[model samples]
Target: MELILALAIGVLFSSGIWLILRPRSFQVITGFMLLSYAVNLFIFITGKIHINKAPLTLDGVPVDPTRYADPLPQGLVLTAIVIGFATTALYLVVLLGSRGLTGTDHVDGKERDHDE
Candidate 1:
């Protein structure tokens, strides 16, 4: 499971980087989203995967690291998701406004001449 997850994260990160290098504004936005997802997944994975375990222990109970899930990563991932969504929305609005004013979706504010 860990190997599979690592591979998935690598793929997402690579694809996101490739898209980020593109000249299209929409593709850049998508790349940022993908990168954010990879980061969230990494944060979640760091908390470790514990099956059938509680997030916290009672005050009287003995604390065992293996038996309890770490809640910090979960909370961080949740917060990151919310922030990523808001940032994505803001980027989309900016992209729309730029497109309307400049009449192009390219990051350079002009279309690339592919014939060269």
Candidate 2:
């Protein structure tokens, strides 16, 4: 499962980077979203993979690091996801305004001539 997650993260990161390098505003926004997802996945994985483990210890039980999943990373990822969503919405608004003013969705603010 870890291997699969690692591979998925790698693929997401690479694809995000590739899209970010493209010339379209929409694509760039999508890339940023993908990058955020990859980061969230990375943060989640750092908390360690434990199956059937509780996130908290029962009262009077000995505290064992191995018995409970770390909650910090999960909390952090949740916060990051919220922030990422807000940022993505902001970016979309900006993209729309840019497109309205410039009449093009390209990063350069101008459409590329096919002949060029």
Stretches of candidate 2 exceeding 4 Å from the true structure: 59-62, 113-116
Query: Which lDDT tens digits does candidate 1 get at residues 57-80?
Result: 879998888788998998999999
Residue 1 lDDT, candidate 2, scale 0-100: 94
lDDT of 2: 0.94
* Backbone clash numbers for all candidates listed: 0, 0
For 1-116, candidate 2 gives per-residue lDDT tens digits of 99999999999999999999999999999999999999999999899987888887799998988889998899999999999999999999999999999999998888888825
The TM-score values for the models, in the order shown, are 0.87, 0.89
Q: How accurate locally, in lDDT, is each candidate?
A: 0.91, 0.94
Candidate 1 TM-score over all chains jointly:
0.87
